[model samples]
Target: MAKSGPNYKVNGKEYYRVSLEIGRDATGKRKTKFFTGKTKKEANQKKQEYINKQILGLKDTKTLWFAQTFNSWLFEVVKMSDIKPTTFARYEGLYRNYINDSPLACISIDKIEPMSIQRYYNDLFKKQKKSSSQISYLNKFIRKFFNYCVDCGYIVNNPCSGNKISLPKEKRSEAIAKKVEIFTDDELNKMLNSDDCKIKYISLFSLATGMRRGEVIALKESDIDIKHNEIHIRRTIATTAIFDENNIKTKQTIVQEPKTKNSIRDIPLPNSLKSIIKKAKLIRNEEKFKAGESYSTKNLDYLFLSERGNFINAGNLDKTWAKFLKNIDIPHKKFHTLRHTYATKQFENDIPLKTVSTLLGHGDIGITADIYTHVLKKQKEKSVDILEII
Candidate 1:
């Protein structure tokens, strides 16, 4: 994720920006590293020196504000890393939207206390209307940064070190009301068979394999094994952060590796999707030969393409999903619900939790355990336990 370069303005003034990734954040989230200077050599040199200072535990000038410290640390983490662009984008958005303008960002780094941070989390949830998950990321950053300060000998103790700080718990009523969004088997059959179903192959493939939207779209002919009835999850296509010659940021199409270690898996194709897959293959081959030299994908083998032969983007896919839902007269839900639908179906059919987790490519088995096994947790309170609850 690191970029180093010099660029010019319209008037021909040149400046340089270099990014270096320093470390991970508290929740093991990736950090952002950014540095800019008037000269290319200076910027690059400063990036190296900054890395060295962290490695050697060098003393600072003692003038670091809370915001300044956070920014500096983020700059290092965002640079020169193997983390995904979507991940970097999330970290950047979290910092800019939630942390940068908070009261916590305005103080001296060493002066921050636990109560102040707790109050900030409360404000973020109660006043700012941020989700509990968002507050948790802020807390993660605060705790990670202060822990680093302690390691650097800048503070005697980390204010965010204790076990007392916790994220907002979901209300019992809200938890009860929250429903797992999924299409029933009957609904799925109707939707797939509907005359108005667009992107039929992709929709069916998602139901069969539980691939994410990005993974499904990024599919290439080379990734599929028609003979073996399986597909390899190697890469994903999405709109991600891209840096330009002028060191500014913009969103552009990117094809990158999968998310986690287990995310890169070989999923067996279900018998139900075989016909759809072959139909898609035939259409693509016909399109390729009909257009001949004019075919944009002649040199490539991507299975899905737009009318113009470009990769089908996520926005258009969602639009197609919406259109299909409208034409089928069904309530709209995220396409991700297909993955959930697959998992729920597997659980209902009595598949093992570990097997489900593996099929879903979850990094942690505990995630599968929590989402699929509703009764595994929350036993009746001991004081009010009822015999023969079943």
Candidate 2:
């Protein structure tokens, strides 16, 4: 008698087998193939191999365009890969902005060659004048998509492989020559003394702690240990687009863990900053009282709240920073410049690199050294001046 189901005994030996439909034969008869192995896992693997071989042998795969294949890859492969929401949103944004309607996207997947991708990148840099960084991001997405295609037998090889593409030389050099920007001492002093209470407090807090904008806004009263003179960096507020079942996108602000374990560290709270924290608390209490029942109860422990009594929006923070700079008669700098300024000041004050790195919550001390190389060079100059005094 023949064995039943997936498990069977063939000549008194155990075996696992699976039957899969390959296609429909001529005259509409169903064609099937059996894959057998010692174990069910092995049998499944054999079945997948056969399916992949059949897909590779199909001539109709040449009809699959890049746009269609990209959508299929995104929903079927990328979406199921367990990436962060922010990262997925970024990938979606890159496809929409750079790849969706481009000429390259209209070509058949199998027809996409190295030079075809190279030309697309060249046009982005030369004709569109898009930055090298932007093109690099687009290239990364395209390369990953093509790699998936190759793995799934849609293509024989990835055109992006083997270093066949590169950015223009001048654009590459431009990106390499970019320098880290930071606020000057005078600018920092001006910002700390701003008449705008919100700006003054947040600026002082950021300058004092060297916290990222997201980390600062995500801070809660509970994270502060006044007796210990320590402030804990726990979480961050990120704004990312969330996609629903139907692929509809909505922007949302979410509190998430810090980017890395090193990002969650404790730093000593300066005595001067203590007074500012106290004042901020008093202001929040006053606002809560005035708003009464209307005050937002969500995340009430948050150290900073907008006028509407909700968590501060990252976009609104940036706009406020820009307006504050303009009002103070200072040249506009990114909010991140405050962080750089703090690190620079530390290096200038002869603080050890390791100590500075830990305070900044850098995962590696080398990262701290590289970013503040200019400051370290200046410190070296000061050391030479001391030698002269000796």
The residue-by-residue lDDT of candidate 2 on 1-390, one tens digit each, is 976554767788889988998689888999987878888989998788667757667334645899887987887678888777778889998878887888887888877888988888898889988877688778888889988777776777889987888765455456445667988778877877778477668878888889988898888999999989999999988788988777899988888888678999999999988888888877778888899888888877988887658878778888988999999989998888888988888888899999999998898999888788778878988665666787
Judged by TM-score, which candidate is best?
2
Cα-based lDDT at residue 292, candidate 1: 72
C-alpha TM-scores of all predictions = 0.75, 0.77
For every candidate structure, what is the RMSD over all alpha carbons to the true structure, in angstroms? 13.9, 11.4
The ten-residue window of minimal lDDT in model 2 covers 168-177
State the local distance difference test value for candidate 2. 0.83
List model 1 lDDT by residue over 1-390, tens digit each.
868456643356667776776679999987877666788777788788666656666554247777777766665654446667777777667677766887877787656777888787787778777776667776776777777777776666788777757677668776545556789777897767776223777887888888988898888878888789888999888877765534378977778888888998988878877777678777677767777777785426777766556677678888998888777777888999999898877766666778888888899999777665452333212235356564
Clashes of each: 12, 0
| Runs off by more than 4 Å, candidate 1 | 1-62, 147-156, 196-198, 244-247, 286-294, 375-390
